[model samples]
Target: MSNTLRISLIAVASAAVLAACGGSDDRNDGYTPPPAQPPVLNVTKVDGRYHHNKSQQDSGFRAMSDMPPSASPAAEIALPALDAQAQTKAQGDSLGGPILIALPQTVAQAQTAEQLASLLHWRQDAQGQQVAALRVQAADALGIRLGLLVQALPDAALLRFYPDSKTAQGYETTGAEINAVLRLNAQAGEQGQAARTWWSPDLGGDAITLEIVLPASAAAEALQLALPSISRRFVDTDSDAALQAPPAQRAGLSKERIPSAGSCNLDMSCYSNGSAERDAVARMSFVRDGKGYFCTGTLLNDAIQSDIPYFITAHHCISSQTVAGSLQTDWFFRTASCGSPYLDARRTTRTRGARLLYTSNVGQGFDATLLALNDAAPPGTYLAGWDARLNNSIQKVLSLHHPNGALGKISGGETQNYANCDGRHCRAATDGRGRYYEVRWGDGTTEGGSSGSALFTQSGHVIGTLHGGTASCSAPDEPDFYGRLDLAFESGLKNFLAAAQRPF
Candidate 1:
């Protein structure tokens, strides 16, 4: 793509000068001159370190290999106890937490933004690519425990953060702990070319800090600073749930920690086929009414080719608009090595919210929900293609998902004949009971976090999203069900997913 910005001011000035000459015949020569072209502002791809910190941390940072030994109590802290209502009242009616500030776009603000970028101590990966970093301190001068929120300029393609070296070594942190205290970054999504807003985790003390990172391609003028409530910082890990570790205490899954018989480990290479299908899968984490939960989803490619960040997941997982808005999405969370012991923790990308577009429950015979993410997927992320044609069934089927919100996992199976359940047959569900594709897995299995995962055909096109199933590692022969994509398309999804306009 060309990085040119055209300005026509020079042409206008020349025209004014010509008019001031009073149309002299000697200079006119009875001929009209061609219009002058506009001046283009050249944009260059920048790569290097940029931040406000003097130096970068070399050690003490926790990587993805540090997952918890076991699940913890889910309700460690109650939602109401976070004092959300009190904080909101104190902020005087602002909904984006206690602190929210619009980013400055003036030339003066751009200069300061550039200065801050220059302060960043950039570091390079093994591939020699530079990454910008900023150390975010959790506490302010007043000793108040708070989480800061900031809106980025509209040119940031991708951004993420991790525990700075000093903070990482202070305690045995888990992935949950890192997520709880420092929510990190947000990047451009499918709908927009860049991200507009971001927030920090609410940490009540000096115990939590982070080093925010962004791609060198980001424009310095786009960075903005913001601060929000302490409650915004917590991951909402209530103790009643099965997964227990705090967000900060966990990391990516290592080889030994991968489930032996149940969920397929993301480290397994069989799941990845180098297609957009692999990149389209994402793990979904959400907090509603002070409780956190996990599910899976896929980025769907639509007819307009707008890259609008349209997403599909199980209606059972998120049927309400409120829960949909509260969602937090993670992308590219798989391992670099097929059977390696460690996953590169730094590669994962995240966003905090989305908009609900459509939804239906199992009783309605079309258990599915469609969403348009508030933020676009990061650069290089995929928007998966779909096949919503009724009566189309492939011999082999596959699924990629996050089981228990752990890591990306793949499952494969053979499609048996369509089975009728709740009075609907496969490939036909309207007015009848819901129809679904039945499959018997060849290996691996799905779990709690796997809900809403996309079911793909052998050719890589998505056919449906997981609805419910009895199949598991302990019961390998049992069958699993997926809501038919054709049904979803006919019911209203066609208006968005279909490439051609067709009346419903």
Candidate 2:
């Protein structure tokens, strides 16, 4: 039994790493965002998207499947938590209404398996005989995907949960807490927007909840229409909903200013003050450590098939991540030199960025994203001036990042070693998981706020994106890892520019 309930945070649509070997904590593929408390997987099968928007403390590794009935996790087969809370807030005859739940993970498992599983589990009941076990075959059973649950709820009806809500004054319910904050009087559009997700964990199992929710509007009564169609009834509108779709986009791409070091402006890389609510409890601060924050990208807006245009970023930076039923969100980029997000608007000038576009649909798991927008490259920004190469790692590349929580950390030469690999999907890893390049940078390594930093070569070329660094600068490990920039974007990015550049 889980000692406590942990709501799943954000999840990404595609996994960064593919576990090709026997799955375990050691060799199984995973990514550690930043250090915080180790994540506790109280339950195994919850569902929610992981948000790549903010700096985070990632949930460790675990293996999963791709199916629907399995879409949302039940509280039954969950890992016990490191902490504890009372279970079964309400049970038995008292079970009914839009349940407020925090699921372990969410996966859409078809009902066939559910029916078979239910039949197999059927046995003697209270009277020593098995009566018809029909809840497993109920009305709301047909629509078992995680999104269906959130979609079923009216936008006016809010659902929100805090993964950090573990203390006494913290939580009201488990999973994504749906408090019905701002009731939007939503109407079904001409065509209800439809979406499907193939998610990867940022935290652990996904999470879901609907306890104190608002009601639905008459126009969008799809959940009501489909609830009756469910034949396999084990699923319920009354019981707790497990890992549902992530509630927020979470990670996003934006721009910041790079200040020259050793000048009147304290010597650092780039800087920004943005929201950390998605990564931690509130806001966080970070700075550069090794060669420090360094990077460059063509902040662009170009024509696609004659009409669209966009600005692009590595997919790992903007893609949504999934977890027990939540999405960790990162809306802006920052460095340690900066304090909490948004000190003063004048201190940091926001860049022209929006609606990220990516190439996940073409084949599968390509790490590329485009920020579809209405404007061309802003002043001081360059759009695609180099060769977007592919599949070849080399030595001696230029590094750029926002350090000390400020800007101008790039322009420093740093040689990095090819550490471990996540899989064919994500190319690089570090012994420090953030310190692969530390073998070079003496004290100028990346700090807390340098994630999403870019690295280039001396000849002025793009190479990789900064992710992690040693636990600290003085640490023994050579902690620095980067996302290689090559492949797919060469073409996919061009297409996005054609589609995204438009009149707002």
- What overall lDDT goes with each candidate model? 0.46, 0.26
Candidate 2 has its poorest 10 consecutive residues by lDDT at 283-292
* Candidate 1 residue-wise lDDT at 220: 41
Model 1 stretches with alpha carbons more than 4 Å out: 1-268, 271-275, 344-346, 392-394, 419-434, 499-504
**Error of model 2, residue 245, in angstroms:** 32
lDDT of 1 by residue, 273-382 (tens): 42447677787765433334567898877654555677898775666544555466766665544543344343444444566666655544456778877655655567
Clashes per model (N, Cα, C within 3 A)? 40, 153
Q: What is the TM-score of each candidate against the true structure?
A: 0.51, 0.34
The list of candidate 2 runs beyond 4 A from truth reads 1-148, 151-342, 346-411, 415-443, 447-452, 456-462, 467-472, 475-483, 497-504
lDDT of 1 at 30: 17
